[model samples]
Target: MSKPRVIYWFRTDLRLHDSPALKVALDLEPECLYPIWTWDPHYVYNARVGPNRWQYLLDCQNDLSSSISKLNPRSKLFLMREGPTTLLPKLFNSWKITHLVYEKDTDAYARQRDIEIAKLAHEAGVEVVTRVGRTLWDSDRLVEKNGGKATMTQKQTIAAGDKIGNIPRPIPAPKFLPDPGELNLDFESQKPDIDADLNAPHRSSSDKSYAKIAGPNGDFAIPTMEELGLTPATTPHRGGETIALKTLAAIIKDEKYTATFEKPNTAPTAFEPQATTLLSPHLHFGSLSCREFYWRVQDVVDNYKGKASQPPTSLTGQLLFREMYFAAHAKLGFSFEQTYGNPECKFIPWHLPSKIDPKSGLKTREYIVDSAQADEWLNRWKYGRTGFPWIDAVMRQLRQEGWIHHLARHAVACFLTRGGCYIDWERGLEVFEEWLIDHEPACNVGNWQWLSCTAFFTQFFRCYSPIAFPQKWDREGKFVRRYVPELVHYPAKYIYEPWKAPIADQKKAGCLVKGDGSEFEDGQLKLYPKPMFDFNERKDLCMKGMKKAYSVGLRGNDPKVIDGSWSALFSDGDHPLGRVEQKTRVDVDEKVGRDRKRRGQGTLDNVITKKE
Candidate 1:
């Protein structure tokens, strides 16, 4: 008799350690254990993604496959056609799959997809098992009074009796994986086009050169974007498990830059300093786990005892993980449209660049205006061509390197969503999704909405002063010069505001100068355009609009509504029943330990976890 076969579906939760879903799948003790990943077109080629992120994902998948293969020698990753609902059912039915293992997804789209898949699996008589690997607390377990959704802010008010405190600690991975011989079932499915589909230009043409630049310290082969049916990106992003871990380790070991983490951005001299990890791409590709990452940092802290002045604490850990959660939910289909005053703004007025050839008078729709202008701005922002230095530099880093500081995300988003208010936040959010390797729908949407003052209770709109921002954040304009080469020749003072310099100064600075000693080059400032909207004017407009909206409101204890709620009745609210607290509890939870570890180290890694 053949041994039963169970399949593990790899999504964002990639690492093997403390992977609840993977552990549960192994517990089934099936004849064959199959691990698979899909290059779904809806996610791969969507406007919300780009080249840098694609490269990073490729690296992550490679690492994950290598890890699984080592543990289960017969376990091979099945790369198949797009659309899990369509392909997954076919594969399972064909192979007589008995059990399906996967991590629960919180994103709206994933949740819907999972429901459909679950229904399909039930009809086919296959048991589907889902584990809570993505979040610290399982969605089913974390609730408020009357079985409602548990909000982060509400958890704070409940003290020891709050929702998370009462939930059972999730089980960790077993000491050893089940043997491949135990599940001796044999099945085959058409492999995904690993080479042709993901054939993006690697750093080198030769496989050897590609491997050298790949920097992965594992046995797996990285797939190209084309192999994954993804479009070849104009630029590449760094990816893989080794790079992510190394980057985290480096941030932890650094000793000289300790002051950056000590204080918040309250004093002018103590402006917020950013420490970053380029783990988003790996996280997206299932090369890393949030729990594993938390534990890894804990290990680093334990190794570097008392080397730094400040110790890590719950406050720092909360600030760090909050953003991670924020990114995940926002990126997964919360849609950039909801982050503005007018949800209809998603379909509002916006320009699409002309693709028509001036010489031939040939009109082209390839560059037709899109309903989502917010997404368009995101494209520009990702490429670092938005003309906003602070925003562009950070965005450029994400595009070119697949990494940037966390606070930088807020700074840049503020520049786009509120700085001008002339553009849409959706555009910015989409760009973030496309370029950022760590793209989480929740965090992306939350950050954008948070900066734009679009969602939750706080309608507070903060428009950044572009002119002053350059001086404050990038005082020397080094970051701007590195990414925006057009301003390379301009003095540090004029680098950010090339349009403000005198004509002679502009000429000397190699900038285009206009007549009458003004710096308007070629109809308008070429290198640097004038401020999109008068900073003061936009500030006044946002302030008045916010004041009117929040005049009479109840401050709901929901992290989503960080600024509280308005009195106006949207009675059928998304979270109508409020937060719920679960009664049963686990003696030990990894999340609590993970949160505690941040305080013990106080390293550069801790800086990122601390609040402003």
Candidate 2:
């Protein structure tokens, strides 16, 4: 008699090595093997998964298929559509597969989807077994010591005090996997196998070459948006895992730049890695476990103990991973999205750039503005062409590439909702959703709303000056010049502040300020409207908003979102909502699910943003 067949569903964890769930399935010794990915339309519509992630997923699946072919050449990956709840039942019933295997994810949507799938599978008399992947410590592993016995905390809050000092290490993968040929299932009933040839990397034409160079690791081939049946949504970031891993390797090799990772303002360049972990997409897919990555790094640290190189920075610490997990849970408890539901939705009396008179020479008293005008500005901004030089430069880079440094994300967001005194963070966030390959609605809205003083404790709201920030981050101005070629001629000194350069210097640099030189663009160049809004003026406006925000606290100072357990040590005393915890204890009652409104599960609400 043939052995039972088991289907292993692949989600975010992609790599073959150190995969706990995969190891378990293989250990079961099924006679037939089924690896699957279900693409849900809701996820795609919400922009939860973009082309960059999708492309990486394809690469990983291709690689997995290749690895399996060596042992069982006929093994293939099944690409199915619809939610897991609907698809799993159909596949299980049609194929008569008795068992299913997968890694359990604590994310809001994934949890909900899993529950529905379990219900459907139960009705179909199929057993669905799930294992923990990604993190070294699953949420169930950590708990508070209550009355001499360990008790798990209900909801998504992290444990109080220092729980990490004594926590046990993560479980390793099983040593052996069962062969694939033994499984007993009707494999013929599943969808046709994908072509392994089309997945190979190919030579790029010049236009294709330009497109490829726009993403993090820009050399690999990615299926077009059409192939994935996706509408042509804009994507600025392009490189997939091939580049992600390469970038990580580069970061690890730069021993001299270790100091850069120490400061919040100067951590490892998200794009320029010493040793790239090609792990994000994998993490998203459930192919490579996060525990595996943690252990891999920990192994390196142990070997290098007291050696020439120090252990990985605490910023990349294991505790940080736990913190992210816990915070995401907290965010789920409260409706983070509704709390900051498009702040620009209610208020909208914002100013636009005044028109310049052609003959009278003075600025026009009126503004040429409407919803259409705002829409036009939004399009230019999203495409990275607001023409503010630095702002546009950052936008252009994101337009060409799928990823940007996290700090750069804050920088661009601040420049818009705060620095520009724009009334709408919703419009800005819409652009982010459309263009960012790594865009997460919960993360994006929360951060933009946080930075714009629309959510959380908006009391200490902050924004970066569009003109001054470039000098601080891109000092040589090369970063800006690379993406914004129009300003390439300007020297490093005047590059950041093109309007400050003299007319003679501007002309020498190729483009005159405001373009006209026959009008005698001489003397100190009075070109390019002198800083649309002065740095001081904008800063003052932002400060006033911050002060006004102090009165409106987060969800009425709910403890889960603002409790002492969640305090950041780096806060100062003067801030109204200081880093200290509040007395009110928030009780999170809901189990993990995809509903963003119930609790803050999987959201970044509690992650410390303060730089040491």
Q: Which candidate has the top score in lDDT?
A: 1
Question: For each candidate, C-alpha RMSD in Å?
Answer: 14.5, 13.4
Candidate 2 residue 533 C-alpha distance from true site, Å: 4.1
Which consecutive 10 residues in model 1 have the weakest lDDT in total? 579-588
lDDT of 2 by residue, 381-495 (tens): 5555454667767777665655666567767776666555453565566556545655544456556655665543244345666666667656677777776665678888887
The whole-model lDDT of each prediction reads: 0.50, 0.48
Instruction: Give the per-residue lDDT digits (tens) of candidate 1, residues 81-157.
Output: 44576667776766678888899887766776788989999988988999877765553444333144323332332
Residue 462, candidate 2: C-alpha displacement in angstroms: 4.9
Q: Cα miss at 45, model 2 (Å)?
A: 3.0
- TM-score per candidate, chains pooled: 0.67, 0.66
Candidate 2 has an lDDT of 0.48
**lDDT, residue 377, model 2:** 46
